[model samples]
Target: MGADTITRTNRVTALAPWLLVLPATMAVFALLAVPVGSTLAESFSNPLGVFENYRRFFASDYNRMVVLRSFWIAFATTAIALAAGFFAAYLIAGSGPRTKRILILLSVFPLLTGVVVRSFGWMVILGRNGILNNALIELGLINAPLSLLFNQGAVLVGMVYLFLPLMILSLVGVLETIDQDLYSAAESLGSSPFGVFRQVTFPLALPGMVVGSILVFTGSLATFVTPRLLGGERQMTLATLLHEKAIISFDWEAANTIATIMIVLTALSLVALGMLAKRLSPKGRA
Candidate 1:
């Protein structure tokens, strides 16, 4: 009886973690896995063939253009956000505690508002007679209001703005974790400011950069509201195309196909970035 009781106790202890996580596992299966499985299954459903929808999508010149444009925009947004966010994060990390709190609050304030509201704000600023054009006109920068709205540039601007905070926050979290002693040691060893940053700060911060890049890239690729409002019909992206297929045309097959492609693209990007992160890691260097 004593031996049996001990065995039972050990088994219970081993299963405790699994039991605790069961609710979350079930919720994920029901909410995420089920819907994603349904979408993938529907994407494969076609009277003609399994690959028919995918074939049709890639065969269309317009679809190809939209996919390429989406990738380009995502890449550009990730690049710009990473650069700017890193700088902002470094500044925030080095600031006094009260100033850091204020800066972080300002960074997070934009995220509290809805994407629709933010996109509309951009529209007001970028319109022909908008605040930006008026300011430029007053300064004699141009003869007339330049066309800024409803273009790829507008979309890029909106995307960068929309995702910049996420990147900055990710980088800030990592930057704060870095040991200040390392900087002191480097300086004591006669390392220049840029050298210290290059040899110590950047390598340690690569993980945050990877995380931020993934977030910004995936968010930019999946975003609909900002691109729809800023890019207009002329500068269509994959997300916009998915919306048109699903909502306007009522084409479930095409919409599902587009969604599947997006999922695959996002997954591939994550995997690629993960591998790149490992390669760039300090341990990997040695």
Candidate 2:
């Protein structure tokens, strides 16, 4: 074949995969991109003008507090999930096949239940006349209900419960990928359990931790049903505020602006998280 023919063939081969995925890519674009683009356009085309919705978002004290509160809840949920999930993942990683299967099934059972169902379940357990209050009263622990169902604390509990499985599953995959030989080698080198984990296992698992953190944080940030149900009207996060704006107030422009801000923040967080993961990797350290 001529050089031109060879080059054309090479180009065609390189393009083949893209060709194969083109249909699915177009479907995704239609489903996700179109809606997002429409929302963005609507936000800019509001009566006050292109930047008006965003101006209100930034300039309003209530809007600013909602943004800050959303991030704060997400951060707290991510931290709590990571702390609990790391140990659970380690246990599952080292467990026998049957034990691992059972643990994983149990961990993921909550996901099978709808978020509304789970939130209601929490309400049943945490409400003033709920199970916890009844138990406490019987035990003489307190005379009155502790008011656990309509605050940030309840939201934290619900969010942590919701996202812990993701963290555990992500960490478990990473932990399982670490060669068993590495642990044996560390042990042969007189490393204790703590030393092996701190020096060898943790460094290798940092990527998973980073992945779990991002997932939990983003999930928490965007969750509306749980926060709204559990925190009631007392707490206002971005997601809940967006819901109120779009549904209750019929303020499409404001809602679209909030959605755009969330998408941008989520994208920025993913990039920053990926960079942080690279920095914490063994190769990055070396």
RMSD of 1: 3.3
Model 2 poorest ten-residue lDDT run: 277-286
Backbone clash count, each prediction separately: 0, 0
Per-model C-alpha RMSD = 3.3, 4.3
Alpha-carbon lDDT, every model: 0.93, 0.91
lDDT of 2 by residue, 32-104 (tens): 8898889878878867778888998899998898899998999999999998999999999999999999999
The number of clashing residue pairs in model 2 is 0
Candidate 2 Cα errors over 4 Å, as ranges: 1-26, 46-49
TM-score of every candidate relative to the true structure: 0.89, 0.87
Error of 2 at 246 (Å): 0.6
Lowest lDDT 10-mer window, candidate 1? 277-286
